[model samples]
Target: MGSAVLDIGGNTGALVVVTGPEWSGREIEISTKDQDPLARTRAAVRARHTGAGTRYTAVFPTLPAGPYVIWRTATEPAGTVVVAGASVTEIEWWQLP
Candidate 1:
């Protein structure tokens, strides 16, 4: 499971990937555009319970500002997002292409 706590500011930010139950327990990988595709970071999908309902998410608590590629597999990228400093970026897993 991933940590819900986030500390973002300045040249740092965070990413939240909302996923489905099928993704639970899976580790999602991401890499900055400037880095080699083989260089990646991983976060585990966890269930979050809220007043509205339960949500499955993978949280990248801290990351540098840049274009990041979210990988669907070792050789496939699901999508990309430009992360800005001092912000929390959220994306739905199913919306990736």
Candidate 2:
């Protein structure tokens, strides 16, 4: 499984998103003393799956600080649900069964 990273910067805070394989359509929010966006993104990705099935992995490093929504969309004609945020963090296309 391969991983990709995206960096986000805003008045709220810095954000990082990651994507790869074995990822479920899930979103995670982390609030900690540490303020490293990269670390946070990495931790978030690690918490998620590596890869599985047509569902590939994806990561969002940063998003507007506040309540947000993360949804899945088809990359192309294939039925792969791409986990996308308000802003694209990282996108990875995996092989289908």
Candidate 3:
């Protein structure tokens, strides 16, 4: 986390997606909201064995500035994100309902 504010009109930024504790071994994806995605990243990491994780975190760097969403499989439990230049936007969601 930094002190810089989001530059809404700038070209790119970062997105951090955090999932609920029980989301181990699941695949998470990011897509531009209402817009076709320019790219997608596959996130797979488990935080269950430690027995103390608050959430599973996924970081997407240099994403185009705009609205996006985090989804797993069918996208039911998705959370939204906004990436503004040089800043990081966070989206937190629980396991699929």
Candidate 4:
């Protein structure tokens, strides 16, 4: 999962999904104080993934909150790779059923 820091004044969020060979589906969940566009997007991603039975979550820092994005990719021959920018907080990998 990958998360990006958002602009404090910004009010939009986005979620991304990438399906892989072993991945059947994904579930993502987000919690926020308000129903901002970004927050809603995060929630939607969570709902979709939850409905599919996958588990995912990405959280950003304060001030801007976040413009977080999450993705799932098929296991690569070289294994998984994660790249983060300066605004990123954490990145994780999981083996799916």
Candidate 5:
């Protein structure tokens, strides 16, 4: 079962940051490529439980499809990803090497 809060469709998409308990209560930032580096959207990391187990994550429910940068800090970038319309983009931070 899923929820209806994610309104991804048309030229819009969604993003999910799959992190770990260590990142709980932290805010994760992201910005579309065309936006100023200083302008970013943020979401607080929360815990979600599924059949597998409980996991920490941040969900950006809706965003315009395009290249986006994941910020490590206000001035540092951790990585980048492309968001596709009508779908969800996920970043598994805990699994990063």
Candidate 6:
């Protein structure tokens, strides 16, 4: 699971990603709010291995207000997070059989 905050101050927020008990230290990516030409060419926001078991945290220190996509790789299963001003949006990922 992961989260991002929406604020007008351009402050960074924390995102916690949880794959499962079997997976740890997985590299995950996040997208910025709204659509920008630079957004596609820009690097995907990456989550770091928290070293806290199966949890990864990605922090955007200067994130603009909008919705962001939190995913493992592709946009599918892309958890949509809406920031309404300094609020934490918790998102989770899963694998289906």
Best candidate per TM-score, number?
Answer: 1
Top candidate on lDDT is 1
lDDT (0 to 1) per candidate: 0.92, 0.37, 0.60, 0.34, 0.86, 0.47
Q: What is the per-residue lDDT of model 3 for residues 4-97, given as tens digits with 9 covering 90 to 100?
A: 2233336778766666656666667877787555455656534523345345666565677877766655645255666787677776665323
RMSD of 6: 6.4
- Candidate 5: clashing pairs of residues: none
Off by over 4 Å in 4: 1-24, 36-39, 43-63, 66-86, 91-97
> Stretches of candidate 5 above 4 Å error?
1-4, 94-97
lDDT of 4 by residue, 13-56 (tens): 23233333243334433333333424422222221244456544
Worst 10 residues of 4 by lDDT: 74-83
Candidate order, TM-score descending: 1, 5, 3, 6, 2, 4
Q: Candidate 5 residues 19-84, lDDT tens each?
A: 879988899999988899888999888888789888788899999999999988788888888899
Using alpha carbons, what is the TM-score of model 1? 0.94
Off by over 4 Å in 6: 1-12, 36-62, 75-77, 95-97
- Report how far residue 4 has shifted in candidate 1, in Å: 1.1
Using all chains and alpha carbons, the TM-scores for the candidates as numbered come to: 0.94, 0.24, 0.59, 0.23, 0.90, 0.46
User: 1-97, model 1: which lDDT tens digit per residue?
Assistant: 3338998999999999999999999999999998999999999999988877889999999999889999999999999988888999999999988
Q: Estimate candidate 2's alpha-carbon lDDT, on a 0 to 1 scale.
A: 0.37
For candidate 4, list the clashing residue pairs, or say none: 8-64, 12-38, 13-38, 20-74, 26-49, 27-49, 27-50, 28-46, 29-46
- Model 2, which residues run further than 4 Å from truth? 10-57, 71-97
Error of 4 at 48 (Å): 19
Point out the worst 10-residue segment of candidate 2 by lDDT.
73-82
lDDT of 6 by residue, 1-97 (tens): 4344433343444444445544444455566646642343222234444456434443443445566766544555355665444544445555311
- Per-residue alpha-carbon lDDT of model 2 for 1-97, expressed as tens digits? 4354555444233333344534445443333223432233223444343445333333445544443323232211211223334454332334321
